[model samples]
Target chain A: MKFSVILDALPYLLEAAVTTIWVSLLGVLLGQVIGVVVCVARQSGGRAADMAGGVYVSFFRGVPLLIQLLLIYYMLPLIGIDVPPLVASIAALGLASGAYVSEIYRGALNAVPHGQSEAALALGFPGRSIWTRILLPQAFRISVPALVNELILLLKASSLISVVGVAELTRTSQTISASNYRPLEIYLAAGVIYLAINGALALFGTLVERRLQQA
Target chain B: MLDLSLLVQYGPSLLRGFGITILCWGAGCLIGMVLGFVLMLLRQLPVKPLRWVIRVYIEVIRGTPFLIQLFLLYSGGPSIGLRLEATTAGILGLGIYGSAYFAEIFRAGYQAVPKGQVEAALSLGMSYGSILKRVIVPAMLVSTIPAIVNMMAILTKETVVLSIITVPELMYEMQTMAAETFATFETILGMALFYWLLVEVVSRLGRRLEARVTRYLTHASPQGSSSETATARA
Candidate 1:
């Protein structure tokens, strides 16, 4: 349990933690967009759109994110649409997160009562405005907790991108541990950093949830 | 633009890898459930330190990624005078990681059981063991089936992380095949299909189990069958 090695590693690990955060934030944001699209497709009342959304959700959710990363990283080059490791990693994370996010949004949407939408309809609100102005706001409030959970999950999962050669926190830890021969302390330090980041995310989620409740 | 011939060439090895994945997942789930159950039981005891330790364990495991956990177990083992093979470390990591979640699920399920039912059992002179076996366990199972199933699906996916440790599971096999044949697309698609099937099977089995348990509970106990059905439907 040498403290010096961890102290030396802290700066590098923190830098890499930023990469982890940046990648995961992008992934989560992209996932939210994809989730909204899929949610709309699922609720669009057309069979093809519904089936397309269903398959997208099932395939992405069913397959592991690690495999998704590998698929994107490797398959893109063969198709002449080459992407860097970071791009592939983010894309994979976003695609996989989109599936889970869509499910969360669906649950939140369902929690919003049907009567609200019907009332808006009877009040002569257009369908688009009714959804965007009325229903989505309530559903967004309902989704905050789950969305936070997904973000934390994605942040933790960003470690998998190390497989594609991204110099993220986990990879930096691995590199340092290999060089320093202090796997236990280094990995534990990495774990602490992860815990700190995730704890803050959880706290933020709690605050948001409280705010939503008050509203 | 897609090719199917690669599957014919790599089918046997991929099948073997799939088997290994299933084996690891099964062993890991068994370990997780048993350990989680024990942890849940321990948490119920009136020991402050024990409860505190269990809470920390759950929070730490839930907060971090399983990849870091696996790295700690596999790479960090030698420092602690514990050296484990990749496969052993992978399975052990999955179990330890999953136990935290399962324990929480068990606790929640136990709490979901109505308080009056436990009180009635207590008043009827039923022993703690009997009440646990006849009343609490059944209701807990009915309530926790979905969560348990969800965790199992998660564990199934986590098996892929084992490949990072060179455990030769499905992902490892796919990567190896892709590197060798340059058939990355085919191998990746095959891997995806295999996992999709596995997850589908797990969810289907969970639904069936839930149905059977709900039916058994409905017939065995008439007092709260309606609410049980409502929960089951939900």
Candidate 2:
């Protein structure tokens, strides 16, 4: 209820929000890379590749991201990989987001009419160009909305990375609230910050979607 | 590099934790569906303020992370004179968080019911109760099963956030076991396997339920296009 508590905590929380954005952006970018690969594997018409892609999607999508984070954060040290908390957090998030992103790409690709691919094939276009030049552009356009949704979800899920000791917004809020004994105001401020970030992302997504539609 | 013996030492406690996880998930989902149904119904009312409030509620819940919500409820409760135990706060937070999504699903389900069919029913002198029962319920159920199932899977995963509040769910158990024995790989993998199985079962059950509902709806209607269209929309 104290306005001063929230006002004082705002600077720290805002600083940490930058970290949240950075982590989520990096995670989403990594996820898109992994997603494209898995999507290609799934669509390649090779049995082993398809199965590998399927298994990757199923395992990542099935398991909770928290456990995945803990697995990476803790298991790597045991194996002498020695990844930092931030790296492990991003890796876990990227690996998990890849599953969802691949599905989004798959849906977008399927939404692109099959006839377009066939027509390109009949025109003597190679399969590689058929995908890269013709299909991928359209599919990427179709995937923008879903990709934005995934990005927002990843931003929210990034709060869990606090478990691995990253001092993101949520963790920083926890720290300040514990010190100041104003959990209500601190958490409420954190939630509003999250809402603002996600709201802006949603608005940006709508603009991109509109631009794509016009194009 | 993987250890199996750690499972023997920690398996019983993990199983207990799994039971709590399932309990919280089941109870939370039930509360969510019921509350969500109420919210959906409230949205249908003509009161502008009520509808606006419900809209804001849905947006706020959907916009933020469940971990923050749980923190607010569990840590911030006493400030608002609403003290809650960790388990109670966890379940309540999950329910409130999930209700927003379920309400949207219910609204979508209602919208999916053809407006023309409702008009036709009204023109045929069908009462509101009978029309809802005979026409809307069946159609909505058929259309909403997959979404409902998907929400259930999501809720199951959200239960892991409950561990942050120290609810002693599967993740909490895994964390404790890992801390105690430094068997992070084994315990984390064990936790993942349990969650994977749970999610697989939920999705498989959802598929079965979808098939059954479609069959039932198709069998009830001679034209059968209703179920087909519903499946297509889904």
Candidate 3:
């Protein structure tokens, strides 16, 4: 294996890795927003909202993210809602991540003892404040590890967005491989970049978890 | 706005595609289960270096995207003169990729088996394989249902990635049909439904299996307060 090929490709691959990060970060943020809303709705005591949230989770979790991306990228154009490749990619990822995030939030929220809520209710605390003060904080603490897992999974999944021709790390590596005919080297370099990114995320997650435990 | 006629036109091919998808997933699941069990057992060995090697293998496989792994296995194979058919590569890639996760699940399940039980079996002069076969395996199977089911769902969704390697699975067939007929939305939606139903079936099977196992255990030990049955009942 020629080392120079990897070095020459490293800069370009890193640039695309930035795109991968950007896309995944946006997806994670958007997914969190969707998750928080869906989680709240599912527990909010409204039948329609709860049912809608259930359907959302089931459908998203059931379907593959690749098909989601393809549908968003292709179908939206026909409906006159033309989304750029990157936008479609982010939207697909965000939507799919939302389902998993909602489940994580649900598990975390359930972990917060029911007695705490009942105690707050007996104390005549308002519902919103009970949630804000007693429930969400505890749920957030419980959710940090799973939230980090979701983030790492999303980062890895961003590779699939390349199917829509968004030139992320995988796509960039594929491009270089095509040009240089060095699939082994280019692919290995891309894998290293992915491992490095995910490794850092895992470390950060552990640090945050430690701090949370300390608090 | 999907054309119903297009569905009628492509139903046979699409059904064939679905069959291929199930074939690949089933084959991959078998390989994953066997390999994952081996990895889990290897993890139990007292050798520190061997355990570390297995740990690294699991981490690396779990850390990267399956798409990259597929490419490396399928496309990179020719570079090493180990060229495999697309279907073979797909099955192998999914199995190898899935073994890391399955190994973790199996390890967790194995750990959930009470240590005392294994010790008791040893004191009774039961051989290692016999103890594992009679005690550890059954207990772990019951404990690992949820994790195993979750992994099955994941592996099923991941089969779509095989399309990248030109495996003639559901997604690959749908992509080909879409390119040929330009019925993008219809074909994509149809494929989505196919996958949705496939996942639903797997989850239903998981629930049934869980119920069956729980029922069998409940019948065997009516007074047992084991948390496994407690959670299973709940």
Candidate 4:
């Protein structure tokens, strides 16, 4: 609540903001890539691959992202695959969001008229061309709104990574609270920062949703 | 540490926390549904000022992260005169946060109800309460069940966050075990698996309930395109 303390802390908080943004962006980006691949695989592949992809989506979608963070943060290191706190957070979020994004993508794919796929094949478009040029492009458009929702969810989910001691906005505020013994102001500041980030993401989502609609 | 004793020892703690998780989720879901329905009803109220207040309540809760709201209630509510218990705060936070989503669900459910059906009920001179309780509620239930199920999954996960405020939930128990045993991987992995099992069971039940309701409707009434079934199917 102290303006002076927030001002004094602004620079440090900005640094933490970088981590938050990076983790969110990285997680969302990675999730989208994995999601698209999984959905495509689920649509076209053998029963085994489809089942595997289904399991991946179901498990991640069913559980809380916080528990996933704990597992990724703690369990990965035991298998001799140590990652930095930021990396672990990103990977865990990537896996969780990927599950959600795949569902969105699959839904969008369902929306694309089946005739379009048949048309591309009748026109002798290569398999890759048929998918990339004909199917996926249109499917991506239907998915824009859901994708935005997932992205915003990722931004919020990033807050959980602070528990594993990543110096993100939440952790930074916790650190400041401990140092200054002012839990209220610091927590409030962190909340404001989260609100600001989420505001930006939501606005961007709305803009994209509008653009997609116009298209 | 790598055997039956681990199960026999920590098993009780995990089981105890399981009960708390169920309590938190069950109570929170029920409260959220009732609160959400009431909020939805308020949306239909003719009183402008009261409706506006409820509208703002829905927006603010929906817009911000639920974690901050939980923290705000836990820390700031007590700072005033609330003196709420941690579990109580958790339940209230989860319920209120969820009600926003549920309000939207209810709103959509109401909108999706067949207008002609309402007209029919009105022509029969049925009171508003009876119409709602008998007709609209059944129809809305069909459309709203899927959304309620989806939100249920999200709420189940959110209960994990209350551990930070010391709710003695599953997540906190896992954190405790990790700290004491240094078997962080095992404890965390076990915790995640426990969460997976709880949600998977719920998801299966939701799907089954959804299918059963739709089947019962089509078989009993031969209705064309069930409204509640569609909503719940969402």
Task: Report per-candidate DockQ.
Answer: 0.85, 0.85, 0.79, 0.56
Pairs that collide in candidate 1 are none
For candidate 1, the per-residue lDDT at A70 reads 80
User: Candidate 3: lDDT of A154?
Assistant: 98
Looking at every candidate separately, what fraction of the true A–B Cα contacts under 8 Å does it contain? 0.83, 0.79, 0.66, 0.47
**Tens-digit lDDT track for model 4 on A29-88?**
999899989998998888998999999998898778888887878768777987888898
Encode model 1's per-residue lDDT on B98-184: one tens digit a residue.
999999988888888889999999999999999999889888888788778888998998999999999988888888988898777
Clashes of 3: 0
Per-residue lDDT of candidate 2, residues B52-170 (tens digit) = 99999999999999999999999999999999988889889989999999999889888877799999999999998899889887787777888888999989888998999999887
Clashing residue pairs in all predictions, respectively, total: 0, 0, 0, 5
What candidate 2 gets wrong by more than 4 Å, as runs, is B1-9, B120-134, B222-234
Docking class of 3: medium
A1-215, model 2: which lDDT tens digit per residue? 99899999899999999999999999999999999889988898699999999989999998888888987887888879988899999999999999999999998999999999999999999999998998888989989998999999999999999988999999999999999999999999999999999999999999999999998
- For model 4, how does the per-residue alpha-carbon lDDT over B1-234 read when each residue is reduced to its tens digit? 444576677778877877787788888888998999999988898999998999877867765667777777777565456678988988888899889989889998898878998899999999999999988888787767777787898798899998987887778776776787777777777777778888887878988897787677677557664654554456
Misplaced by over 4 Å in model 1 are B1-12, B225-234
Model 1 Cα displacement at A16 (Å)?
Answer: 0.7
Write one digit per residue (lDDT tens) for candidate 3, span B51-132: 9999999999988999998888887678878789999999999899989988998887887777898999999999999999
TM-score of chain A of 4: 0.94
- By lDDT rank, best first, the candidates go 2, 1, 3, 4
What lDDT would each prediction earn against the true structure?
Answer: 0.89, 0.90, 0.88, 0.82
